[model samples]
Target: MSNDTKARMIDAAIDALQRRGVAGMSFTEILDASGAARGAIYHHFPGGKGELVAEAATRNGQDVRAHMAALPGTTPAAIVDNFLAAVRPVVAASAGGGGCAVAAITVEPDGDALRTIADTAFTSWTTALAERLGATGVEPAEAADLATALIGLLEGAHILCRAAGTLEPFERTARAATELIRSRYPHQKQSR
Candidate 1:
């Protein structure tokens, strides 16, 4: 009911969602993970896992948007490079071993809530990237397409990296992304 409690629930849900695919997850698991009682989960998410997941998905989406908004650039390629750099520590810390929550949930069967969240997050991320791209002279729709490609590459790379337990997949993907970005905006300078 309280803002803090709601935030805690979302945090716990995010952790659980990341670790377990949506449908396979349970209310008991979330309660145990967050150390909250059934009443808390009910009070915050009466519809149970689906509601929590939807909220979690929105939270995650907002996080990505925040990162994009916080960027100091007016260029699409620069924003993406910064985003990738920001993600590097997370990937390296896990030894490149974890698929993205959005990507994972998108694949699981009957995880409509999870899938919706994933789709929304990815869409928001691409939208943010598209804004940056437009600032750098890319047409709005073209920027959106570019943003989608970048996200797809990043998400797919994360999955591969996790499966291989190696950073090579990520590095390779980053290299290709950099190249694609450069080819698309040859005159644009890369952010340090």
Candidate 2:
């Protein structure tokens, strides 16, 4: 298959994983969504759905990490706000149709390879957040802990917002997370 076809398949798989979870995704669905030829699936992903899904999940995680790393701010509050801003559109676009790909995959019993991808993605996010927090003077250990909490807050809030069919949960969690991060750096101006 051509590289375009392969990339489209990956993109389609990511969307399917985010929207429907692992059990819901199928070769037929991917083919329909991507508009790739049936032969492309085997050509691109000889290992079948598992390989394709794992690659898609890994790419999603990397995209998230890159987004976090590129957040344009020097302060924890600014960083947090930027992070929320970056995520808001995605959640809004999904409109309760789906949620974070890593979160969705983590909860499903999709075997060790997929689980490891989810774990790595979560770790990448947490590590990026922690590094940003540490740059703002939070101790390394405390920043790590807080970063993990922030990830949990955001992921849980995403699920809650999806379930409730409203953005209120995510909004509330974003505010609380900003406050928590700001609290750690009390000297910074509070303008979030």
Candidate 3:
């Protein structure tokens, strides 16, 4: 039941972000929409909306890392494919309302908090893939670069695909990413 309440609050928070783009989301709105009282939210997230948003964003980042970690192989191409596969479906279903959490927070006025949250989330994600890349013989520097490039491409793909209302943008982005990986990393290509 406690877990359920937390999930509900998180869901409400994401909905608030989706509808209002973060700037307009408030504790009152989240509590009302979540059907959760202020006390309940405060109990779960005492730092209020910033805390809630940070937690929600961290959870989103964790999910992204978990999905990438679940990919079949250690190769760069395999990792990218796993990520694209997971992302395409979610983005398609969201119809663009589920924009990147980092992107959403990038608009916030406080540069320090935004930097901390974005860096933490991104570092967590990059570190996960960097581990896999190391296992596949990629150098530390190359792994970091590859991880950064893949993330940038995926974010761009998400924006373009959602804006176009078509999967073509995603497909094109995936193909280009795959080609880049293949040419640079020489991984066996898997048909998408």
Candidate 4:
């Protein structure tokens, strides 16, 4: 099997995890979503669905980490603003939340290893976010806590928006996250 097939399978697995959670995500759905040869599943992921799910969840977390690293701005407030600017349009254009893959696995990890993977995914996000905030004048310890709060706000916003089928929750979350940064570090004004 080609690497392309493996990547597609992983991507499909991520989608399944987000939409269906671990208990509901199925190999059949992964294969159908990916358009990968059924036989390729075993060839690509010998450890089976659990292994595939773990990899997908990790990838989802890393994808967001990469996005945060690339967000524009050299200050906390600006970072928050730029990040919101990038995601707001996508959130508005979508039918609703994209659903968080890591959270899906987190809520229903099938095994101890899967649980660890979920924790790693969450920690990866906080660590990446903390690094960004810390670089921009926020104290390291405060940045870490702030990062966790911001991520918590984001996840809560996603759930609320998905349930309500509206962007108002996200708008509130964006404002809240921005206000939070402002309150915590009133010294770091928006760079843009």
| Candidate No. with top lDDT | 2
lDDT of each: 0.73, 0.82, 0.72, 0.79
Off by over 4 Å in 1: 93-97
Task: Please state every model's RMSD to the true fold in angstroms.
Answer: 2.4, 1.8, 2.8, 2.2
lDDT of 2 by residue, 120-172 (tens): 99999999988987877778998799778878877876778778888887888
Candidate closest to the true structure, highest TM-score: 2
* Higher-ranked by TM-score: 1 or 2: 2
- What TM-score goes with each of the models? 0.84, 0.92, 0.82, 0.89
Clashes of each: 0, 0, 0, 0
**87-115, model 4: which lDDT tens digit per residue?**
67545533254677887776763477777
Q: List ranges where model 3 is wrong by over 4 Å.
A: 93-95, 187-192
Q: Candidate 2 — what's its lDDT? A: 0.82
lDDT of 4: 0.79
Model 1: colliding residue pairs: none
Please estimate how well model 1 matches the true structure, expressed as its whole-model Cα lDDT.
0.73
